[model samples]
Target: MVNKILISFFVRRLPEIRRSKGVTRKEIAKGVGITLGKYDKWEAGKVLPKSEDIARIASFYEMSVDEFLGLTEEESEAIKQKLIEDAERLSPEARKIVVDAMTDKQA
Candidate 1:
């Protein structure tokens, strides 16, 4: 499930990020492969995008998902470290899965 707080943060940050990139909403929508109306709704906070769509949009913005969601670099790094620490407590196979997913490389 999507975090409501993250979605709210993303909604508030979307326009700011777009403006900083000097791109229009339509451009972002097209780049991210979402409909312009859907992108409009996302910016308007009428609805949240699916997780995959959120990832796509972040990729389009050339940002990490946390960055795209308005987290500071320190905040993102802290979260990553926390996840890594937590994953260390999991079973070996699960830990490998988590590490691989995070690194996008063989664990």
Candidate 2:
């Protein structure tokens, strides 16, 4: 299930990010492989995008999903910590993969 708070944040933040980046809705839609109408609905808060769409949009901005959703620094840190804690319980190989992925994303 999607969190309503995060959805609200995403709705509010997306256009701000786009405007700040000087990009048009049409550009974002084309870049993310979504229709302009769908992007319009998302920007207007008429509907939420699917998770895959959200990820694509974030990637288009070169940001993580959390960053795209306007999560505070503390919230982002907390999520990172939680992921690290969970990864600690995984097998060494699995932990390495998780760490590497995280590192690669940051880079």
Candidate 3:
């Protein structure tokens, strides 16, 4: 029951999130290594992403999959909130440097 609500909310909120983040759908598709049609389907609530794809999308937003799906507990949300605050304190250059370092580490 809860899962269904979360899934519905996630499907509805995804495109809003992307737009709020100022990233194009094409950019999100390329970043997630999915085709634009598939991304569009997910955004349109015509399909649900696989768990792995959900995780990938969550990572792109720098959020946990549970949080991205609006299924996070208060404590988990508080932690994410703190992290977001800290990130927001960084200068754009500093943020880029941190992002680049993380990307390099991932590679």
Candidate 4:
């Protein structure tokens, strides 16, 4: 199993990947073989995907595990255009979290 890094590593990359796939949350959930709610939690950083599941998601997005975890922003951005799309789907509360993150403000 990959040693878990900060949970944010994977969480931060989700929006980018979503942007790249041209997929909706429903489609991403379906592609990942999980429920939309669960997948949303994963993307929203409320939960972390198991190591293997992370790998699977990386593969589904045609990226490396490192890329999926936001370790490589340039490549990740190129591959994760769909991630920004999903960011819009986050709930109001979730958007606050994202906003705080953007402003370097901690909740």
Give the winner by TM-score: 2
TM-score for model 3?
Answer: 0.59
Model 4 lDDT tens row, 1-107: 33245456556667777887787888878886779998888877778875445655766776665545655656655434443455477666554433333233111
Ranking by lDDT: 2, 1, 3, 4
Q: Please state every model's RMSD to the true fold in angstroms.
A: 6.8, 6.1, 10.4, 14.5
Q: Which residue window of length 10 is worst by lDDT in model 2?
A: 96-105
The sequence of per-residue lDDT tens digits that candidate 3 reaches over residues 28-76 is: 9998889999998888777777545665777788765555666546655
The full ranking of all candidates by TM-score, starting with the best, is: 2, 1, 3, 4
lDDT of 1 by residue, 1-107 (tens): 45677567767788989999999999999998878999998888888775456556766876766756666767767766876787767777656544544453212
- Candidate 2, 1-107: lDDT as tens digits: 45676567667788899999999999999999979999998877778875456657777887775667666777867866776887788777656655654454577
Better of 3 and 4 by lDDT: 3
Which residue pairs collide in model 1, if any? none
Which candidate achieves the best lDDT against the true structure? 2
Measured against the true structure, the TM-scores of the candidates, in listed sequence, are: 0.62, 0.63, 0.59, 0.54
Clashes of each: 0, 0, 0, 10
Instruction: Go through the candidates in order and give each one's C-alpha lDDT.
Output: 0.72, 0.74, 0.68, 0.61
User: Which pairs, if any, clash in model 3?
Assistant: none
lDDT of 1: 0.72
Displacement of the residue 16 alpha carbon in candidate 4, Å: 1.5
Question: In model 2, which regions exceed 4 Å deviation?
Answer: 1-7, 72-107
